[model samples]
Structures are given as structure tokens and as C-alpha cells.
Target: MASESPEMNRLHPFSAVTTTLNRGIVGLSVPFFLIGVLSSVTDAVDPVWSIYLAPIGLVAGVAYGLTYYYRFEYALTQDTFDLSSGVFSRRSREIPFRRIQNVDVRQGLVQQLLGVAVVTIETAGGGDTEAQLNFVSEDEANRLQREIRRLTAAANGERSATEAETASSDEDEDEEATSNETADLETAATPERHSDPGVSEDERHEQPVDHGEPTRLFELSSRELGLYSFTSFSFAAVGGVLFLLLFANDAIFGLLISMAEPLGGPANLDSASPLEYGVFGIISLVNGLALTYLFSVVYTFLGYYGFQVGRAGEDLVYERGLLQRYSGSIPLEKVQSLTVSDNPLQRQIGYAGLWIETAGYGPDSGGGSQSAIPLARKRRVYGFAERLSGLERPSFRRPTTVARRRYLGRYSIIAGVVVAGAFGLSLVTAVENWWLAAVVFLAVPPAAHLRWVNLGYYVGEDNLVIRSGFWKRRTTVVPYYRLQTVSTRRSIFQRRLGLASLVVDTASSRTFFWATPTIYDLEYEVAREINETTRQRLQSALRERARSSDSEDGDAGVSVAFT
Candidate 1:
């Protein structure tokens, strides 16, 4: 790709588009922001002709300045990488080749149309001292990826020429071994045997090969993405609706104050003109469901809209974005675990979520790197994740939920606390309502019962799969290594019942409200079994790897030990 001068380069590459876009988007929401400001000013002023120009200008200027600072320049140097930007701070990021972990090339819709892709290089250490680049042509993207890979390999003292000759002769033998072995990765045979360094981005271009699958750059059916309005966080559509509805300032205020209470249930109840109430109920129910569906549609569109996923070399790449396109890639070897989820609804419909838990992408990520792929069949999830996970048997296990009776008792206690608190407060304050407490009491029993029935776990060779959710059920799998920590807890009631809750914490932004409270008791024997087995397995694997390396060192006649 031809290099563009900074003066004319409008496309943001190696720049903070997220930060710039944040400013622009927020600045553009002036209409919404102004409404509140104008209303408050108008109420305070006698002459409404007076304006608040200073505040308006100040807000826009600050946002613009923020956006400007976010632009940057990044380049891959001969032996090191560097990134420079920041409006006032003018900070520069430079790192040696050894610090780089992985390189990614991503292309979103607009980028694809423009024949451009963003190349990202990530490292494991903390602090904002790493390099990040944003926009480059597809040619440059490939070139940059190879450059980083070459430098990183060289830094590790990789003997590429020797490794290549050895790998070429080993390939046939490895293929034969693959036939005999039950499992072996496709990549293991090739080992990325390449000898080119200092190759230009344009020179690195290679013709693409067919993968024999439906090479869908974009995957979505009209009914699935549009009609169902589904997303990774299913039923989270409600939160989006509530956010929009919060702009329903009138409604929010009505709720906040006791103003809506004396409206006497809006004449929609059965007792107040039964026919009218029935008609209203029909209308209200439809409206509520439609409103709920709206959330699904918006989430599906904004987050996963224009989603495109495909394989690039040995990596699985996914690109999705609406106003701003985002593309990311994951190396197969970096992946630590694979998770599959299916709700009753999803099972009936034949669609499941495929998730990859990668060590690079935080093995502790509970949901793993996800794909919006519609692998509906049970066999399909296994078939795909197995291939995606290099054909390893995923440790598939269902999460255990405490029995219905146990949950019921817990809910009963929660309900009693809420009810008693409300009942006592109502008498003393005359401000609190006892009816809300009654609804809580009625609701807890069935919700708890449903929760218990829905909870289950599946244990596979390498992953533990968890399935739960009442209405819009969700199943997620988390590997034992993905766990940051694990603990057990039990209430007095649970102690009496001879059950304890096992909680596994993964590093995720996903809330643990529904997740942590559940994770019912695994017997001491079962808990010990899992811990000991994994611990021993990990130890044996590490020792085996060490032994192999030692043999390699011995073959090279390298002496170390006490020397």
C-alpha cells in the first residue's frame, strides 16, 4: 500500500477513534442535552429571550479538544514499535520487540470498502505504555502483521532457517502421526514456517484459499437479527428500553414522586368497568411486549449489527460495528477454553452461541471471545468448537443449582425480610406502601422455584458448561484455568440442608448477580476430585514440556544446572 502523508490522511489509523468518536457523538447529542438546560433556564428567567451561549460553546469546545488529542501516529520500527499522540500531554509509546505478544489485522465494513484494515499489537504487561495503530490498507495490515511476527520471533532467538528445514521434513511424518493420533492441531504440523523479514506490506500479499465452509464475511438472517432482536446479552434489551424511557422524563418523575399512585391504577384494572379494563389490558400487554422486543432489536443492531466473521490464516477474526466498525482477531493457540450455550428457546430454534476463552484475551473472561454464529444443533456446537478449539474434548459440565426446596426456602427468607420491613415501616412512616411488599412475597416463591429447575451443569474433558436462566435462559461454560479464584459459601439454612455454594470468579465485566448467588453445592468429594485432577494434570503437562525442552537442550549440548 502506498504511504499517505499525515496532512491528507483523513482515515484514522493508529489513532484514538474511540475517544474522538466519543466526543463527536456526545457533541452531536446537543438536542437532548439542550432540552434539559433550556427548560431549567427558561423556568428561572423572567425574559425567556435571554440565552446561555457561553455554556453551550464551552461544552462543544471541550468535547472538540478531547477529540483532537485522541488522534495519533503509530509505526513499526526496525527493532522496536512506537506510538505518539495526546493533545496537551504529547505522550509517546515505544516498546522493544520482546514486549509484543500478538498482532491482529481487522477490517470492518467501511474499512473493507476502503480496502483498509486496522492492525493491533497487544502485550501482556500493565500500564498504557504499549503501541496501538488504527487504520492502514489491507496490504499494509498484512505487512505490519508479518513485521511484528518476525521481530518478535527474532527477539526470542528463533532459528527460522534451521526451523524451516526441520519443519519441512517433519511435515510428512507429522501428518502420518496425525492419522495415528486421536487429536492434533492443523497448525502444529506447519508451525508457521516462513523465512521472510523486512518484506514490504505490498510484497507480503498472498492469494487467499478456500476453507470449504460457507465463507460468510457477514452472517445474519432477517428473522434472527431483526425480528427476534436477540443479542449476546439476551433480554438485556430491557435495560436499553429503560434507558430510552428514562428520557421519558415525565414518566420517571411520576414514578419518583407519589403522583402516579393516586391515579387509582389508571382505570385499567378489572373492577373498574370490566370491559374497558380487559381492552386496556390487551393493549398494555401488547405494548409492553413490543417495548421489550424493541430493546432486542436495538441491541442486535448497534452491537452486533453488520457483524462479519471469517478465518484469516490460523486465526478466527470477527468484525462488527454500526456507526464505528470494530474488528478483532484471535490466534487459535492462545485460546484456553471453548464455551457453548443453549436456552430451551434456542434449542428448539436450533441456534447456540460459540465462545472462545483465550489466554491472551483474558482466560479469566467468563464468556470468552464470542461469535454470533448460529450453531443451533447440539452436535454442531461440539463439531465447531472442537475444530475451533483444535479438536480437544471441551470439559463440558452443567453447573449445579441447589434443589427447588433449597432455593424456595432462601427466597422465603428474603421475602419475609422485605415484607416485614415494609409492614413495620408503613405503620410508623405512613409513607411506604404495604402492597409492594405483598407483590415481593408473591413473586419470590415462583422465581426461586424456576431458577432451581433451570440450573444444571455439564462436564466435558476440558471445560465446565453452565446452563441457567428462567425466561430467556442462557448457558455459559468457563474453564477451570479461567477461574481467577474459587470459594464456597453457605447460609445457616444451607448448612442445615447439607449444601454449600461453589463460586468461581472469572475476570469479566459481566455482572455476577445471577451467577454468583447460584453455583449450588458440589459435594466435598466432587470438589476435591476436580481440584486434584486439574492440579495433577497441569503439573504433569508442565513437567512433560520441561522434559521435552531439556532433551532439546541436551541434543544441542547446552550445559546449565549449577554452572
Candidate 2:
């Protein structure tokens, strides 16, 4: 066990009380639920005994909380953040400053009431939070965030200086051995340096002057939030409500019928005409959908209330949420890709959202990809993406006509199956308008054509752009150096159609549930060629970046020596 020093800090004393309450609620729930079940099933467990479980659990929780509070200690060392925790078994962890990617502060309702917050530290290549302080003074949390950022910046600066010195030493030795040859090499490289198209805007402006003040990039207004909520309707919310209704249908219908009887409503649905049934079903569905939409609107409002994003030195900082506040920073150096996304409705309205993916951050750590701008105009989003990624908007190449044929065949088969099913049902039932379902066939051609038109890929000088998805179109921009793996995959159906998908994997690509950055339904040969070309370009980009860094380091060293 490590002895406590002046540098070591413990959580706020009130953490014991909050921890007790949190644990007590959880501990009491299980026993009370079990007691209720046992009392209903048998006479062995009395319902009155459930009342005693609360105090017992509370006492146990208080004891555990006290122990845990005493056992936990943390300290900030020069190069690492050290933690000592565990009540029953001792465990210690040291997280290096270089590995830390983000330091986020979050406060739930209970914590807010208590005037404390949870501080989570995310590290490189980890799916979950590397370390968390459950309950700390809000001031302490802020201080910790600032301290981590300062330390990380200082560490990185020192590393860069050391590398520059080393590179300068190596260059000096090379010049001494071949001074004439080095002079000739420099002459040959001068023109190539000026005309290198592979050099990115970021490389040109490697380090921007920092004023120590955050630059606000975007903010969400109430009107725009509402518009975004309504346009980005979540079918998942509707499905959840439907799922709940399925299991509680009997009780829900009985209550509804009882309420209707008071108003002298229809006594039996069985005696209604087919037309009446259709009207009733439509009314119910419309009502359900309206309720679902309202729920989604409220959910979105709560989640994104007072949302804002800004650039703070080398980090992108964001703060959001109404009830559970979240404030976090994303290290710009770790960013892997940027995505501009919009639904068909939003696209028509000229609005979109921007999302950023960073290494070691995902759904398990609060959210999959952080939203740089939750809602904005399409042009504003594109401009922001280009500025952050250092790449211009790309001109996309549409898939070949063969890919369009595949989509047509696919949607047509789906329409055929649905129409056939409806016709078969009409033969067995008294319904007369089953042929109306054939109208689905009328949509197949347009739907297939729209899907093809929306799918495209562009290989830029320093980045790869992929645009896909019909319902929620996303234009993903992945820089060449950020690309982890590039491959061509052919599904069984795609193989039959002689088509393949080019998949570009990055550090954060696998974190989301949707497909990675992919160009789907391309010619097999074309996909293979793209795959190989992307790999070669990735290698070249890395080499170019390395040379650029070395040249910068040498220049710095020369200036310092001259001074």
C-alpha cells in the first residue's frame, strides 16, 4: 500500500453519503423485488420483512462506502497520473500523460444536487474509460482537467524538442561525411519541396498561434434543435413503445374500452365493417406515431440542450445536456475522421450535422462519435469539416451502371414478394383491394435509382471520401495517414453480381454499429485496384509526413544554433 503524501488527494467527504445512497438503492431493489415475488408465490416470506431490508442494505452500503472512500487515493505525478483503489483487494494504476486522449467531466442530477461531478479519463486504444473519479468537488474536477491538458502539452513539447536535437545531430554527422553531396541533394530537393502536392494545409501550418482563449465554432439554438429533432425522427423510439404495448395490450385495451363505454362508444370491434376497421387501425397508428415523435422530441431536447463546441488550443471542446451535463475535450492530434451527415429531409432543407471520430473513444465511453455540430446548414458543415480535416470538398465518382442494375433487381424482387403475399392473402380473405399493394412496384425503379445516385467515392490527394446511405447519408473524410487497413470484400450476393465493397478501416471505424467507411457495389476489379492504390498512397503519405517533420526539425535546430 502506498502511503498518503501531500500530493495525494481523496474524493470529497460527501462522496460517502452519495455512494451509500446509490449502492443502497441498488441493494434494496433486488431483495424487495424477490420478497414481493416470494410473498405472492408462497407463504414463507412475509411482505413486512421487505421493509426491514432497506435499513439493512443501507447499513451495509454505508460501511462499504466508507471503506471504499478510505481506500481510494490519486495523485498527479510529473509524467503520469497515479491511482490507488479497491476496498477488499489493493490495486494501483499509472496512466502516462502521453497516452491520455480525453478528460471529461460529467454530472448527473444527483451529483449536481450534491455539487460534485465525475471525472473520466480516456486513454489511447481503449474502448472504455481508463479511470474515473466517481465523486469529486466540481472545482477539483475542473482543476484536474486543466492540469492534465497542461501536463500533456508540456510533455509533447519536450518530446518534440528532443527529437529535433537528435535529428540535428544526425544531419550534422551526414554533412561532415559528404558536405558536397549534401549541398547537391539540397539543391535537387528545393524545387520538389515547393511543388509537393501531397503536403496538406495542416503540414504547412503545423502549429497555429494559441491565444489561450477558446474559439467558439458552433452553437445550437432552440429553433434549430426542434427542427433537427422533428426531421431526424428516431424509429427506435417508436419500436420501443410498440414493444411495451405488445406485452401490456390486454390491460391497455381494457382500460381504453372502459373509458370509451362512458362516452357510449362502440361496444364491439368484431361487428365493425372492414372499412371501419381500416379507419380505426389508421387512427391508432397515427396516434402511436404522434406519441413516438413527441417522445423523441423531448428526448433530443434534454440530451442536447445548450449544446456548444469550441476550439481550445489543440483540443476541440464540447459541452451539452440539460439534466446530465457533459463537458469534454477531444485531442485534435488523435482525430481519425470527420463525417457530415443528414437525412433526406434535412438534405432537402439544406441542413446537416458534423461528427468527429477519435481514437479510443466510442459508444462505451458515453457516445460513439462526438458531434462537432449537432445541426447546421450544409455549407457551414462542409466548411467546418474542410477546415478541421485540411482537405477540400471532393468530387465524388458514381458507381457503374452495373451497380444500378443490381439495386433495381434487388428492389424489384422485394416488391414482387410483397405483392405476391398480398395477392395470396386476398384469395384466402374477404378483402377486395389487395391489388392496391401492387403500387409498391411503382416505387422500385425510383428508389433503386436514388440509391445508386446517392452512393459515390472520391480519392483525393491526401484523403479518401465516401458517400453512402439513403435514409441518413454520410460523407466520411478519412485522411491517408489515418487509414489503418484497406481491403476489398465480396459478399455472396455481391459476388454473383460481380461487385465488391472497398472498406477503409480506421482506429475508430469499428466503434459504430453502422457500416464502416465503404464504397459499396463497385466493380470487383475496380475495388481491388482502389484497395491497392489506397495502400500505396498511405505508405507514400506517411513517408512524406516523416520527411516534412525531419525538415522542420532541422530548420529549428539550425535557427537555435545560429542564435
Candidate 3:
């Protein structure tokens, strides 16, 4: 029996409501406000006319939503996933199965309430998502993800088989006539396999592939979550508080004055004792820090609540979030490298995070990378990274001593600039004791030494590990097979100091920015040697991987023939 062909489908009907709210209301909000202001300023138009615009905009929004809903369509064809959508100008896209990298499903608060989800598809080499099916039924979103995965796997298998057969044929042609005769004899003796009569080609290809039961790898406990939140120390929270104070200074000052009335208010501050002044200042500083910490805790909890990670066959599956749920998979085969990262606070508390960097953009990821374990014990995080990359914690080799001098000079310049700026401002303003600002210079030496201590790299048998940064340290492990390029770099100062840096580039999008993995300020000769050795190792690893893949493909082909 022939399998039915897939038909074009539209988004869930509730999508129109979401579209109206997200697009229509947001689009008209500014114009509506402007019209209302115009009516109030000039009596050329009645305020009643401005009121009518609300219903008019709502109707326009609904009409636009219905039109958008009708125009958008998607279908899963035999070879490609097709989409067509337009409001003013028509646009269409066809994405081939083999090119698809990931299919992620996400549901924001509104979509969750409406029982709908957004399906985002990503492909290799793109900086953004390849396709998004906005507002589909939850079940339909899952079905699409499964279907796309199955088709992609089948397509890749067929392509690999074809290439293998071609390579085998070429090898056979290069052999002597005696070997060819033997091969012909073996081929003639082997029995030919026949397909089942009832199974169509489409049905055979569409047969479900078992991904196996998910093995839970990690889960964030409530206690650990709290600790993670507390230690994260988001600067965004502090910035938000500062911004609020900037915009609402009068109201905030009034409240502060009312609260300080018991302390004789701001009016009596001139006559206050030194002890009283110290206490008041301490209380204010503590209150500000506490408020910032509270904001950070709330934000972290909302983003990471109920975080869980599991392995399902060839992919690592993760689900996280409290209000807006997200579920995605990291394809093991596509992973470029693994990064173990921790800030100063996390390092002190013996906790760190594991990040997975892949070949293409990840849904809601930070530059082609996503957190595999947001927060875990240091030992556990290192263990997980080793399990994936087969490398233990490396003893990193520090850079040349001159690198430390370079850092000291760099930090001293920064401190000098800061102090100069403060002193200059004091000279202009009514501020006294401008010389006290030189205290910043005292921190420069320690800061430079700490930076030098944190910067190091280790060249392993099959992986390259580079650790760097003092405030937000990251230890990245890159397998030779995943290496794309290796080069040495030197600045004018580095050249003068006989120093160079080794940069290892990967397919990760993070490399597009200046965040490419680098071993900083090594001896020039050492950097050159390592760069050459790494390139050689990269070639060897590629060849080994190719042989391994061919062996597995041959085994799979044999099993299929026997079946």
C-alpha cells in the first residue's frame, strides 16, 4: 500500500489572537498615543475622534491577523520542508532534510496558555534560525520535530551509502585483474536480498527510528538552584536599580527622606556624630546591595527553574524554564567543543557550569553555545566534560614571565587613567582630598598577577585545553578532530618581548567574534612549534575519524543486506 502524501497545514487558529496581540497592538500603540496627544494639544480634532481610533485599530488588527493566518502555510514534502508566508509581498522557502541541524520547540507564557508552541529549525553555517513555524499545536510541533529528524537521518544515511559505494568502486578498479575476478566470484555467489512485498519505499523510509529511553544525566535541586542564583551576581540587576534611580530621583529621594525622618532627616546630617554617620552609610549601602541581590535571585529562578538534562541516543536533551518553557537537543555529532566555565564566586564555592558549543546557531543560545549543566559541583562538571571528550583535568603550562610584566604595565595604565580622571573631576568640582583617588593604583599589581595566574594552556594527546580570564574564567577543551585552523599571532609589544599567541579556530560561531580559543603570550618559538604540531595532529585526527566512520557504515550496510 502506498503511503498518503503530506498536505499543507496552517498554524493553530489561536495564532491569530497571538498575532493580534504581538503585532497589531504593538504596531498601533505609538500611533494611538501620538493621535491622543495631538487631540489634547490642538482642538483641530475632537478627543472623541481619538477614542474612535481604538476600535478602528482593533478591527484592523483582527483583519490583519486573519489575513496572515490564511496566507501562511507549511508542508513536509518527500525531500524538503516547504513554507510560504506573506502579508504584503509573498515569500517561499524550501529546506532540504540533510541540511537541517536542529529542531527546537519552545512555548512562551501566552503560547503555553493557548496550548501552542513555536518550532524553530536551524542549519549549518547560519548565524540565525533557518526556519520558524510560529504558533503550532503542541502535539503538531512534536510531530514535526520527530518527522524532520527521521527524514534528516535517512537522507544522510543514503548520501553516505552512495559515497561509500563510489569509493569502493574506484578502489576495485585500481586493483589487479586477479582481485577483480575474485570480487566478481564473491558477488555472484552472494544471494540477492528482496524487499517485503507489502512495504512501500516511503513506508520503509518513514519507519520510526527508536532513539531509546532517555537516561537522566542531571537535574537542578531547589537548594542548588538557590545557591546558583545567589552566586551568579547579575550586574544587570544593579544596572536596573541605577536606571530606576536616575529616572525617578525625586520620588525616590522623597521616600528616602521619609524613611530617614527618625534619624533627623538630611537636614541634621551636618551636626551628626561620626559614629552615627558611619552607621547610616552602612545601612544604606547594605539596603542597596540587598535589593540588587533580590532582583538577581528572582531573575535567575524564573529562567532556570526545573532545569533537567538527559541523553537520548545520539543527542543530549535539555528542558528548562518556569514561565516560558524550552526543550531542545544538542546533536553529539555536531558538537565542536566543550567549555567548563566559572566566575570568581562559583570557583570559591566549588561550583561550575558546562557549555556545549556546536557547529551552528542554537535556539536561544549565546553564540552557538548553550549551557549543558548550568550549575554543578566542580568535580561533577569536570567529570561530565571528561566523559564527553575523554580528557582529564589538565596541568596547564603558564606563559613567559614577560607576559606578567605586560599585564602589570597594562593594568597600571588603566589605574593611572582612572585616578587622573577622578582627580581632574575633583579639580573642577567642589570635591576635596583629590589625592586619595591614587588608592586605585594599589590594586593594579595584584590584579595583573591574578590575571597572569589564570591564563594558561595545555596541549593533550588528542585535545587542546586553554584556560583564561580572572573574573569569568573559562577552560575550553577542543578535540583535534574538530579543529578548523591553527595560527600564531604577535602584537608590536609581544614582538618586542619575544612573545606570541596561538589561536585555535573551530566551526563554532563564537569564533566569529574575538572569543576564539587562544593561548596567550608564549615564547615566540614555542608558539610556532605548537601551531605546526597542532595542524599536523588535526590532519591525523580527521583521517582517523574518516576511517572509523567508513567502518561503521560498512557494518551497517552489511546488517541491512542480511535483514
Candidate 4:
């Protein structure tokens, strides 16, 4: 029998109340609480009204949330997914499967407690194209994500097969047979539409997909994790340690005031020598720094206790976190950039950090999607990068002597201005000693020289490598085709110096600024050459990928798991 036509379905029934409460807490509760606090402190509103404001606001929020939930509906069609939502202003969207770039399942503390998750659908075009189904059961959300992946893969497979057949008439019969087989497979894989209106589309079909055991690449041991924490050097941990050292003693002494008066009293070191006091202060400072480092180490260990990364099919799967237990996968093809970096201490210890930046996975997504390898050796970093991008390391081109001179002049001018200003202010206000500023300004030339020497970029056959930084060095490798834009930019200063910066932008939002991959302080001609080379390389990569894809489609079997 033919399955009933797919129809729009409501989220889990409990989602209404759970969502209402969640919304109330996020949107209304805070405002109401603040208003109540303000009202009690001031005469803006009657005290009696303030007392009822929270309950009233909560009720209104629930009412609005329920109405919004009732209006929202989602349906899966053969070619596209449809979403209809909005209470006052109705909004409807039909997103083609081809446009969908990523489907993510996210669960927060509240969602975890309620056993529900939010499934976000990120498309090639962001903003309005992005669709979210919130407050679905965890099981339902996973099922929905899998279904979307399956449908999208099937669609892509068919399209690729058609393109292959069009390109080669000799494979038309084989292509036709593949199409029939794919249709049969899709039909067999997709479960019939659930008859019960109460059952969500996802909940109706939750069959698991079995792939071979994942090949483990890296796993953090307890000892390695401990070492990682020690090197993490988190500012938050240092600040926390400082806070405890400064303020915690007061509370402890306050509790035992009568017994601790003598011990808490100010020290009378007048009888002691200045050398003794100096030694004591130095020891105390060392202890404080050690305590802070220990705290940072502990935090790192907890954060990455069970970190493990592996390759499963065409995806890189990583699971970590002791308390949160986060597990995420990044499609190898979606990865836009990979960075291997190290601080001075980490470098000395022969360790580097790895970060994989992918499209549609911004830092705002709780940092779950961005692949971060906390600590690894240089070889391991390159190995992971090679597996993910299928590109080897490229030799970098260092900055020219003229560029170094330009950097020196630029840094000296800026440093001189700041130092002169500080010195003048100190002399006028009778504050700090002026000689300090002069001493700092003297180091500007070497600082600039080091920066220029450290800065370098390489445009390779299939990848671009950018090396930068002094204190914490980083080498970012970006695939040619991943680049979205390549341009030569010049500031007024750069123009005067006959120098320009080459900015390579990609779809990965994880980069510091609009996904920028920059090579700075190059001669104008060199910058333009680099930009042109990047453009040509990108075009070549695209054509190569197209040809490779066509050839893959003509092959007997192609795993569309990541497509």
C-alpha cells in the first residue's frame, strides 16, 4: 500500500510546556526579577504590583510560547523540507535538500534534563535559510538528523550519477541500473510515514546505521592530560587562584576571629633585614604562581579527561569532556582550515595544538563542531591535517629585507609615540619614572624584526600555508578550493611603504575575523602575485574536484555517507 503523504508534524507534546518554561526563563524571568528588584529599591512601580510581576510575566511568557509552538510545523517532502511558523506574522520556508549544508543536534542543561534536544539545519545560505526544530526528544532529534543526511546523500548520489551518464553515453545502462538500485535502496531505507499523529517523523524511524569500527588516531591518557592542563595556562584559572589567595583567607579568619586574631594581625618585620623580606616575598610570589598553574592544570584535565579522536568513514569523530561528555563529527570535506600552533613553553616541550575550522560550525554553537586537538606533537598535527585535507605541508616564503625595514620603521614610530606620550604624562603628573618608557621604546626595533622574520606565507598546488606570531606561533593550512575570496588590501601606511596585505577569506566562521586567512606586509607586486596565484589555484582545484567527482560517480560503488 502507498504510504500516506508526508504532513507537517508538531514537536513532542511536552515540548510546549518545556519550551514555554525555557523561554520564560531566558526571556521573561530575568527581566521580571530585575524589575522586581528595581521596584523594591525605587518607587517606579507599587510594591504590590512588583510582587505579582514575576508570576504575571511568567504566565504571559507561557501563553506566548504555547501560541508560538502551536503555530510551528515541519514537514519533509521528496525534494525539500518545509517549515511553517510564527504567531502574529506567519512565516513559511521550503529549503531544498541540495542547499542544506549541515544538520546538528544540540542539547543544553535544560534540554538534557528534559531528555529533549534542538536540531538545527544550516544551509549553504545562512540567515533565513537556517531552520531549527527545538525541544524534540533526544532520540527524535538524532533520528531526524540521520534521515536528513540519508535523504541528502541519496539526492546527491542521484545527481552525480546523472552527471556521469551525461558525460559518458557508454555508461548510460549502468547509470540507469544504479539509479534503479539507489531508488530501491532509498525506498527500502526510508520507513513508511507513521500513522499515529502523536508520533514524530523522527521517532517513527530510528533504525541505526552500522559502519565498520572507527580507526582510532588519538586518545588522551591520564598522564598526558595532566601535562596538557599544566601547559594550557588558562587566564581564568590564574584569576581564580588569585581571587582565592587574596580573599579566601579573610573569610576563613572571619569564621575563627577570636582564635585567629594574633595570626591575622599585620606582620612586624621591622626587626628582620631587607634581604630576608625580599626572599620571603619572592618565595610567596613563586608559590602563588605555582598554585595558579596547578589550578589551570586541573581545569584542563577536567575539560579534556576522556578526549579521543578517530576517523569513521569520511568523517572525523571526536569525543571529550568529563562532565559534559560532548561527541561531535566533522565531515572531512567540510573542513576549511587547519591550524597548528604552539606557545613558547609548549614548543620547548615539543607539543602543539590543532584546530580544524569547518563551514557552518561557528564558535557560537557551543564550540561543539569546531575540532580542537588540545595537545599533540608536530608530526601528529601534520598527520591529522593530511588525513582531513589530503594535502601535504608546503614550504613557506619568508618576508623580504625591505619588508623587514618597513616593519621596523612602522613599529618604531608607533612605539615611540606611545612611549613619548607616557613619559611626558609621567613627568607632568609626577607618577611613574620616565626612564621606564624610554627603556621599553628601545626594544621596538628587535620586536619588529622578529615579527617580520616570523611572518611568511606559501601558495602551493592545492593548499596555502600562512605562518605567523612570535610568543605563540601558528601555521594555518587552507585548501585552495576552500577559499571564498582572495584580494590584495592596502592601508594608507602600507600604500606609502609600497606594501600590501593579501587576505584570503573562507566560509569557515571559526577564523578570528570573518574567516580571514591573511599574509601581511608584502611588497605590492608580491601581494598581487600571491592574490592572482591563489585565484588560479582555487580555480584549478575546483576543476580538478569536478573531474574527480565525475570519475567517482562512474565507479562501481561510492560511499555517500558524508555527501
Which candidate achieves the best TM-score against the true structure?
A: 2
Against the true structure, candidate 3 has what lDDT? 0.73
Candidate 3 C-alpha lDDT tens digits along 391-472: 7558889998889999999988998898888889998997788788889899988998999999989888778899999878
- Which digits, one per residue and each the tens of the lDDT, describe model 4 over residues 169-224? 44445435444543333334233223224223443343322322344556776766
lDDT values for all models: 0.50, 0.74, 0.73, 0.65
Per-model TM-score versus the true fold: 0.60, 0.80, 0.79, 0.70
Candidate 2 on 1-563: residue-level lDDT in tens? Answer: 24433578899888877776776677767668888999999998899988988677667767777788888899888778899899888889999888887788998888888889999898865567788998899999988887787677666555654665654444335333222322332343344334544333433332223324455556787877887888887556777677768886667656544444444434456675555555556655666677788877776777788998866555677888889998888777778788898999999988899988877765322444788888877766776676566565688999888889988999999999998999999899877798899899999999999999999899887788999988989999988878888888898989998999998998873443556799999999889888888888889877766664555444323212111
Question: How well does candidate 1 match the true structure in TM-score terms?
Answer: 0.60
In model 1, state the lDDT of residue 60: 76
Task: Name model 4 segments beyond 4 Å from true.
Answer: 1-14, 20-82, 86-90, 108-115, 127-129, 166-217, 233-303, 310-314, 360-369, 490-499, 510-515, 523-525, 553-563
- The number of clashing residue pairs in each candidate reads 20, 0, 0, 0
Question: Clash pairs of candidate 4?
Answer: none
- Tens digits of per-residue lDDT, candidate 1, 1-563, equal 11322322223433344555565566545544665567776775333322354345446755774556444556656556766666657776677776554465556667678777766666545423145555676776666665555454343333322433444434344333322321123223222212223222432332233222213322544545553345334457787666766676755434423322243333323245544554555655555567777667675666556665654433455666575555555544345445566555666666565655443332113233445354334554555554443334434343344456776777888888888888888888855668677777678777787787766655544445555676555555554434555666666766666666566555432343334323565554465565555455445545544564444332211111100
Candidate 2 colliding pairs: none
TM-score of 2: 0.80
**In model 2, where do residues sit more than 4 Å from their true spots?**
1-6, 22-60, 124-126, 166-213, 239-277, 363-367, 423-434, 491-498, 509-512, 553-563
Please report the candidate that would top lDDT against the real structure.
2
